[model samples]
Target: MKAWEIQESFGISHLVQVERPDPTPGPYEVVVKMTAMSLNYRDLMMVTGRYNPRQPLPLVPLSDGVGEVISVGAEVTQVQPGDRVAGCFFEHWTCGKPSREALKSSQGGPADGMLMTHKIIHENGVVHVPAYLSDEEAATLPCAAVTAWNALFTEGNLRPGETVLCLGTGGVSVFAAQLALAVGARPIVTSSSDEKLTKLQALGISAGDCINYRNTPDWEESVLSLTDGVGVDHILEVGGAGTLEKSLACVRFGGNIYQIGILAGVTKDMSVIPILRNRVRVQGIYVGDRQSFDAMNAGIAQTKIQPVIDRVFDFEEAPEAFTHIEAAAHVGKICIRV
Candidate 1:
């Protein structure tokens, strides 16, 4: 088997594609023959040693991938050989409240992740991919999509006819838009690139729903104006501290704010007065548990939604994938065909 390993010296240049002995699954484990993998901002942080400088070296990178079950352990009964599936972002968190043990099982960080030719996964840690999505599309789901679903459906209790604000056109934001549309909720997307906003518009988002954050730095006003000054029912807060205050402004009184990323700056000086005065709710959304992933897949299967992929790189171009994500030029998901 071949895998991309993040060497001791971090950065994309240190990512080496190397050979490894084929893995044999333990009891209750399954062997996945990876067909496609997707990149995330966290992957870039890991590669650059920005998130955890002391993260163990020579680690397999990337947590999102869709593969076929090539073999299963004797006790594995959840999936059979040839079933297409994607690894759960958390190998141990099945459902409900997460614990330290469950959180520790997450890939692309504390644990070895996807991004290899053949990887071992716990039988319960992989789910059947939606039939509507191709391998490339399914490869984008394990982290970003699940996190979006957790923020909206699981935590926000989002309803149709409600307005939602998407912070950017990254993977999670795009997935939020897709899921919002699937449930008949309206999505307003913001992007610095007018071209990226156009991509969202092409996907059935209303012409007036796209906002160019670069042109209008105070874009929260645009969101409020769109809602007739009531503000949106929910805001997907992927921008972190840099935009948290703006998000607090854009959300309606008592509306939910799903904190999913820190793309803008990890730490910022901000007041909590708005949250207190408006009676707003802010929920931190991690990539969800297996139960959430299953529910999301069921909804996606029903809606027949296909995740938007900005580009796909060949397996050999893994290093370039990291570079591409670091550039932040893509409108949606960037995948690698394994």
Candidate 2:
């Protein structure tokens, strides 16, 4: 088996590919031959040693991937050889509330991830993928797509005809937009680039529904205007402290703000007045459990939703893929064909 590792140091240039003995499955385990992988902002941070400086070195660094089941242990009955599956971000989080034990099983950082030609995982840690999606598309689901689904549907309880405010054109935001459209909800997406905003229009978002944040600095006010002063029913707030104030200002009373990331900044001197005043519900969403992943796959299969992939690199170009994501130029997910 071959895999890329962040050996001895953290940085994209330091990623080194090496070989290891192929894995054998234990009882209740399965061996998957990875076909594709995708990049997330967290993956870039992990490689650069910013996500968790205490994380051990020589880690395989990607949480999202899809593969074919080449072998299974004697007791494994959830899936069989030749089945297509996507690895779960948190291998032990099968259902219900997350716990310390479940958090320890998170892939691509604290644990070895699926960046290799072959990976051995518990049968409970992988989900059957939608039949209609290509390997590259299905590979983007583990982290970003599941987080979006958990935020919007599982926690937010997004209803049809309600408005959703997507912060940017990143994987989670774009997936939230697509999922919103799939369920008959309205999506208003904001981007720093007009070019990216134009590209989003092709993905079912209309020009009137897109906001160029560079041109409209007070985009939250624009969101309010678009909603006829009532404000949106749900918000995918990825910008943390730097944008939370504005997010609070635009979300309707009793509306849900699913906090999924801290892309802007982790700390800021912001008021929490609106939170209580407006009776808003701000929930922090981690990636989600296996039951939710299964439900999301079912929706994707029924709706024929296609994940937005910006680029695909060859297996040997893994380091280049990391560099590309570090540049933050992609409109959506960046993938690697393993």
Candidate 3:
């Protein structure tokens, strides 16, 4: 087996491809021949020694992947050889609320990720990919897609005709927009670039629905105007402290704000009294549990939803993919085809 390991050092330049012995499955585990993987902003932080400075070195650094089962252990039953599946971001969070133990088992950092040609994982840690999606598309689901689904349907309980405000055109934002459309919710997307905003319009978002935050600095007010001053029903607030205030200002009373990222500035000061006075819900959404992933997959299959992939790099070019994502130029998910 061949894998990219963050050897003795902690930086993208230190990622090295090396040969390793193939993994043998435990009684309840399976071996998958990984076919594709996707990059996340966290992956960049992990490789650059920012996500967790003490994260042990020599780790594989990606959370999302799709693969084909090639072997199953004697007691494994949920999946079998030849089945197509995507790895769960949290291997142990099968259902309900996440536990401390489940967080320890999250892939890409504490666990050996599926950035290689082969991987061994518990049968309970994989979800069958939708038949309508290709490996590259399904590979984007484990982190971004599932997080968006959990933020909206699982927590937000998004309703048709209700409005969703997605902060930007990143992977989670794009997936949220697609999932909103799939569920009949209107999505108001904001991007720093008009070019990126226009690109979203090509993906079935009406020009009226895309807001250039650069042009409209008070984009939250634009969101309010778009919804006739009632404010959006939900806001996918990934920008953290830097944008949390505006998100709070744009939400309807009792609306939910799904806090999923710290891409903007983690240390910036922001007010919290609005969350109390407005009775707004600020749900902290980690990736998601396996049951929710299955539920989201079912909806995805029915809606024939296609993940918006900004670019697909060959497996050997995984490092380049990291650099591309670091540039923050992509409008959606950046993938590595194994």
Model 2, residue 232: distance off in Å is 0.9
> After best superposition, candidate 1 residue 233: deviation in angstroms?
0.7
lDDT (Cα atoms) of all candidates against the true structure: 0.92, 0.93, 0.91
How well does candidate 3 match the true structure in TM-score terms? 0.98
For model 2, the superposed segments whose C-alpha errors exceed 4 Å read: none
Write model 1 residue lDDT over 199-246, tens digit each, in one string: 888889997999999999999999999999999998899999999999
Compute the lDDT of residue 62 as modeled in candidate 1.
94
Candidate 3 lDDT by residue in tens digits, 84-160: 99999988889987779988888999887878999888998999999889999999999999999999999888899
Per-candidate total of colliding backbone pairs: 0, 0, 0
Candidate 3: stretches off by over 4 Å: none
Error of 1 at 320 (Å): 0.7
In model 3, state the lDDT of residue 43.
89
lDDT of 3: 0.91
Poorest lDDT segment (10 consecutive residues) of candidate 1: 106-115
